[model samples]
Target chain A: MAYSATVGSVRHVFPDLKTVLARASPMRSGDVLAGVAAGSEQERVAAQLALADVALRDFLAADFVPYEDDEVTRLIIDTHDAEAFAPVSHMTVGELRDWLLSYDADGTAIAALSPGLTPEMAAAVSKLMRNRDLIQVARRIRVMTAFRSTLGGEGVMSTRLQPNHPTDDPRGVVASIIDGLMYGCGDAVIGINPATDSPVATIALLQMIDEIRETYEIPTQSCVLSHVTTSITCMERGAPMDLVFQSIAGTQAANAGFGITLDLLAQAQEAALSLKRGTVGDDVMYFETGQGAALSAGAHFGMDLQTVETRAYAVARAFKPLLVNTVVGFLGPEYLYDGKQIHRAGLEDHFCGKLLGLPMGCDVCYTNHAEADQDDMDTLLTSLGAAGCTFFITVPGSDDVMLGYQSASYHDALYVREVLGTRPAPEFEAWMQRMGMVGVDGRVRELPVAQHPVGALAELREHAA
Target chain B: MSGAADDAGAGAGASAPASAASTEPTEPGLRVVDPWLELRRFTPARIGLGRAGDALATKDQLALRLAHAQARDAVHAALDVDAIRGALDGHEVLHVRSAAPDRATYLQRPDLGRVLAEGEAARLRSAAVPVEAKGGPAVGATSGFDLAFVLADGLSPVAVQEHAASVLRATVSALPGWSVAPVVVATQARVALGDPIGEAIGARFVVVLVGERPGLSAADSLGLYLTYEPRTGRRDSERNCISNVRPPVGLSYEAAGHKLATLLREGLRLGLTGVGLKDEGPSLGA
Candidate 1:
């Protein structure tokens, strides 16, 4: 059926629900490249207006990708929590937005409603929200998870110490890890993006990090961001793995492109669980998502990029992951185009993921080809910090030599922690305190490397060797 | 670099308890040198740089900014057409522009970069005719050349300027008696630009040598894309890519050319390029 909206003497028509949702999205280059973007500003505003009145229940009836054709669509329909969604089931998309921002929709209320809200409903409501609205609504909701240390609480922000190397050099990776640890980073997890995507290389890196964790007794988890299949292979070889990591997407086809399936992810999760690696909680999966992944894979099924990205959160939601990060701006200029688009997309991903009951973080990063810089990242970092994002990917000097992109530096995380008045995970905070790295105020102390016992460069040499 | 050395010297001597000033702890404006700074020899990653109160030291920050600036410049830099044409003086070359009119448009609208501008396709189609076709039944035009090479100034034009011509020269030298078409140099182009160019030339295969997106450490990394039975609207799944083709830091010109030659030989023999063809030739260990 056609959807129509009349605005000031101009009447616009959209062919179907998918068209309405696609046209209603904020302008992004990927949407334009897909040939589904609104033709003009007038058409865009009209679509948004038409989308505002869409009943929340309408999303259940209109399958963007057919339920039979896609496992993601089937997952959304099969696992919905009707009891949690009872309160807002009658609300329109605009009404849902209003209700989310209302005084009554506190943390507890939103947490209860998370399981009931489908990805499409959350995406529709996000479309009607401004940047401030997105942040304001998201800040009130908290989705906490844990493995060795608890994450996501009031006045808490964590950092993923990403010590990536060009050739997966063990010394280089260990050196960067030590650099971040000195700054009181790596609370969320110490993950690596291995240069070589092979099982042998992955096992070597995993064993190295596992040795570090065991020797230091740091209260944190570790992951090697390889393919789920590779992680499974490592598991079969009895490699010391903490969190099973994979790059997931919104559509079934996109996940297939990454050589993954829902069943494979479930199997990997069970394998990780069988190891009994967690100390605090059982959430063991670590997922990395981005907006243009499905579109880039050519598996978006003619849906808008943002909406498709939201669907990926549903996949993460089902897994009960400890960390779900949006690697924004890494897709380059064709998907986002500029700093403004990346910044906005980062917030939207966080908000939608949090709304769907998932622990949401962001890799506030950019490639050289994208029209973005550290200043833009600082803006997104500050904004997401205020919005209570769970964690961020922090590297040495903010340069990922392996991936060839810039992300939040270990110092950048410190800057955010200082300015936002937030602290790290409680367990990791206590460990840092024990090492004299952070003071009583939970702020990292300014200790000379020669005086501080663990701050000495000799410690790294001993560890790496 | 000297300052770092001085700091290292100071750090070593201060811990010896020889100077009374050492008891007072680190002085203001002095960087607390990371003891593991010497470990930087193991990898190129920026590690063990001492910090100044939860921030990068002035020297390290400046070094990072310089690298970032070089990478950004590489991304926006224009392909040096005259120099490339000069480098390939002995070989026939054809120059054309994509539908994208300028650099900014080329970056934002990749769709425009995949198709030729008005009349550019006609020029390529007309150029497809072999000299013998003027006398015969146009069999060479229908059968087409064995392969066509395209040089596209993708994200990092610096890569194209530095390594594209050299790699192309090495690749052509490897294949003798092959009916290779006049090399097409496209500005404001993407990988798929080779598809339409190949289709117009009626070539059996198209090999695109385009500049890869610049990374902070390596600004001039070239990428090679090969497509068999090239045509418009081909999915990326139908093509094979050999990435990071820059010397010393990445795949060298000789190795990259050798690998491409192997793929072309294998692709022609296998009747495909994408998933069907695997680069099982001598591995490029670098």
Candidate 2:
């Protein structure tokens, strides 16, 4: 027979037919199905072979035409790869006959094709044919290929700076105020600024603080002090200072919006740093800067449409190396246009062009002062990609609430799954550690520790005492 | 029979007695009710009620019924022409009238209405809006908005007439970020026709609000169809639908404004569509 040579060669390599036959019966349907519903391509082929064997046995007893051993072997060779055929090496004589009959091939021709004609050899050929038949089966089992449910209920941290107000507690209100402005209330603590002396400012500041504290029960963090100016002021005193610049001059004192020209931003950043040396310690400072204005509205501070591009380039380039961190709060149309134009002009090349660019660790805050939605998020993410900005900040409760959460979670999960390839729990723990937050495990070491902290801390305290 | 005759005769006798007593020249049984009628009543040529009653006994009465039926048909033809003209603008109309087994079959078989009868496509092509001079960006017409509006016999034609203008106005105002030209309204259009119309107009996006196929409970439903980057190459996945167009059940006009704006923006950004867009997660608001 044509298949005799192939069968003899296969049997010679592994001579354990009886052991394979004994294990065939009493197999659970789920196990058999799962074996066929394998993950890799190789496993899927093996499972198909097993199912074919069962189908052949049933078909042989029925009125269907019997399949020959050579025809069965031919089908197996056509369908499955040679290297992954070992799993189907063991099939009983009955299973082999059944597999052949199920496939409706000539059983007499198969017997004539085999030179040695051992029950083991015949069974193996039958298994191979069964694998081939799997392709033709309509209701074949299915195994899910993608991992969709892995990143459930994960939270992303996003930060933003609110419009500064007076009478805000510096230490206790900064976090909530920024959180409220970023995610829109309840997620973080906020502070009051001491700059404004008006009763209304005081009342509004107090009300916001009470509301946030009552809602989340988290203490507020102070705003950075240098962000306060005549047009824009930090809400709390003794808060870390960051520069507040505006192109709209006296109009800045009146709800200036977030629109600042690049030149003004650079000037403000420099000036604020200088002022910080006199009032506060020279610790590394955080800068939360943003630009705003109506896009169609006329440009202010000698910055017309023509000069805005060049000015923005200069400002971003200058601030690339100075600040500890920066959040570019872009509120309105002016910022949108500026962002698009700046990107088109290759400002990203100057700041983030190189593999080892100077501003490697900067965080971005891309907020729309207006109501934001999913479209806004897509646009912002596109812009961030264009600017080569890797890290993103998201405030909860923006437009596309669920989508925003999903996007953020999916992005983080993909990074872990595809890039790092870490398992879910370990990856989750690592992410929490990086964020300076605690996970479900209650342990709060700054980093993963090898030794127990109780023993080490106890010995240290004993020495100190 | 005698009792019936006696009742009729008694009623007639009471009225005729006064006339008979004062008649100057009257036949023996004929009572003259008026002086002018008395001469005519006595004349042998004058055959009043007796001759009229005899005329009703012939089979010629059926002929009058046929004449009335013909007149009714003529009136209906004229009314149908007027309705077609009003519905189709000045464009010639082609209708495929169906005699279905029942109303259920008519409602269930939307595919039957989608395609025009034989030679209808050709007829429609001849009457279609002419292609104007193509000026502006060098890209193909497919690069921008194709057919902007399509009309249909949704749940309620009245609702379409009422809310279509406002919805279009809101969509246009919100989409200032993109260029929009004149909007067109196609009468008797179907949802599937959106693709063909979009192809004809050379629009990148087509927004169609049509009357929905009404249910027993709701006869005035409206539906929205928005196809992005609309072109011959586009697939069904590229099109997004905002269904339940009427107020209350789904999106309101104001809410639809934001939703449409977001959909258009995403479509523009992604360029490609389908499960890719749906899986892009929820809309801007949700």
Candidate 3:
């Protein structure tokens, strides 16, 4: 409990992740090196596989069960003693909102309910009771604690740089990186989706992200959105394996689509952790899912896509992934076809994922062939931004050549920040200032001459001085 | 979507059996339209289902979920090859698996799903030409069979287990005396494996009946992929497809076979297949 802290209403761990670091025991990464140095070739090989299997099996189920105490749940229960808050219990939503505004204007009491209820849950439950509400609750949530590699040592809203490249085109990849970093993005992870399934092609993409990170000194993680097996291969082969990525569903068949088993997932976790990939401790995995994937995988077991999707959070949370996103409209209609459906599904996924205590984000997007337009994405983005979403996909001009769809763009992030008053992860915000992307007056600057290739070094240095 | 509706039913009113009128629109401020109910047609596609506030109505939600479950079941369902062969009683059969080791590997590594297991391929390759040639002209004299009907469980094995035999029966009936090779039943297969299987078996042309990815409402849907001078590495553009061979609602096996037979005849005559050749099965009145 000493490792935890409260920000507004939700409780979060101050989380140095000592337990995770300590558990890298029994098989210290050093043990493998030692065995290889001190044994026969076959013994060394056996030692390696044995350690790998243990690491995979060590995927702790405890992580998915919400490690922090549900303090907000207690607050929600306390409010149910209608006699305690009877003065406002019979009032209408708007009136209750206004009354709470006048009474607890700073919103401390109202913010306390946010971690307990997502927007949809709040909407459905607060119908009859005036005192019980999340419309008011949402307006007050200030601090959120989410893991994104080394980014969250405290509480904040964060966004990742999903600069997906078709065939890992370096120029296109670099352009999106430049655009995202300028707009104060990538506080979370700069994950990529590779065009080819080949493990070699995937490693090449991770190398690209690594080079960019080293050159710019960006304090974030990078990933090639390849399958987990490929990612594990990259880590083992000494490629930059910051976040191991995979697509997961609620059933065996869906999980099979990515060649994953419980043992495989655990192995992937152990593999990444063995490399000590995270500077912020064991938050190494990155998972993406769409609504109908469970059904698509033949593993829904009679549950709806939403419930099955929610169940996938258990898979995600198990490895303590730094980011878990729902690529909502990716599956197309017949599952969730139009913009309205996309918006509703996005909110539901975000709310459900957050309620289950994962760092939830939404890919506010539409395929060229889907029954959705940019306006639908607008609705989804704004709603999710207002509801404390953790991240959104931003590509160059919103067209992902690889995935062949349009998603939220860099400008959309600015729009959410401008309209909703949300800020990027604070460390990222500081970097934005240092690079002169956004200035003291809270207005974004043109990409500073200093940050451009054409800008003269002496001139830029004098300008800075 | 069906499951969502059931959830809505459970959430809005658990006791209502026949009518959802209790939770029906009382407030005139909004009206939720049941998209399908508004129309007077049958469609596998979901429509007209109105919203419960901003989400799907209870019935629509439950229906969607139900469709989803059925679709999942369709994909995960294994092809009952023995049952299929039994249904086509006394027919000689050849069983094969794609290079993919199992269902999981097949889904992830599709490249593996497009070829025959090496041993099976080699076995077919080594078999001598048929001793007897029957039906039509000798399509390929070097390899004595006119055709091989390869059955593959592509995305949904349910499609193969439920509909492939009936369709095969319809197909065989249509082509009365055509010299067909023993039917090749393949597991963990994709459409292109028809090429390797056909070439190995020494067939001049191949008709592959495989399962299509299950749609929300239509799970047991069968599809036919036709190829000429079949071999490995055939592009999708080079093959003609006769799809959605589900019972009752989709194309009947008789009709599907007619279309496939038409394509085979046309493709053989033209000495080519795929995009240039179109199915005039309807006009030809097979």
For model 2, how does the per-residue alpha-carbon lDDT over B47-83 read when each residue is reduced to its tens digit? 1111112121122223222322322221111113234
At residue A414, give the lDDT of candidate 1: 82
lDDT: the better of candidates 2 and 3: 3
Which of the CAPRI classes, incorrect, acceptable, medium or high, describes model 1?
Answer: acceptable
TM-score of each: 0.90, 0.25, 0.50
TM-score of 1: 0.90
Chain A fold similarity by TM-score, each prediction? 0.98, 0.30, 0.68
Give lDDT tens digits, candidate 3, residues A207-292: 77777676666667887877777777777788878777888765555676557876788898888878775554567777887776
Q: How big is the positional error of residue B141 in model 3, measured in Å on the Cα after superposition?
A: 11
Q: What is candidate 1's lDDT per residue for A175-246, written digit by digit as tens?
A: 788778878889999999987888999998888888888877899999998889999999999999999998
Better of 1 and 2 by DockQ: 1
Which consecutive 10 residues in model 3 chain A have the weakest lDDT in total? A27-36
The alpha-carbon deviation from the true structure for residue A69 of candidate 2, after best TM-score superposition, in angstroms, is 87
- The parts of candidate 3 lying over 4 Å away from their true place are A1-156, A448-465, B1-286
What value of lDDT does candidate 2 attain over all alpha carbons?
0.32
Per-residue C-alpha lDDT of model 1 across residues B1-286, encoded as one tens digit per residue: 0001000000000000011112233677665444554556555666556667667778777777777798889878888888889988886788889999998777767789889999999998886675346443331234777778898988778888999999998887776656777889999998898999998987888999988777775777788999998999887778888887878767888888888988887777677889777877443222
| DockQ of all models, two decimals each | 0.31, 0.01, 0.03
Q: Candidate 3: how many backbone clashes?
A: 27
Candidate 1 residues lying further than 4 Å off, grouped into runs, are A440-442, A448-452, A455-465, B1-34, B128-144, B233-241, B262-286
Best by DockQ: 1
Error of 3 at A158 (Å): 3.1
- Kindly give the stretch of ten consecutive residues in candidate 3 chain B with the minimal lDDT sum: B5-14
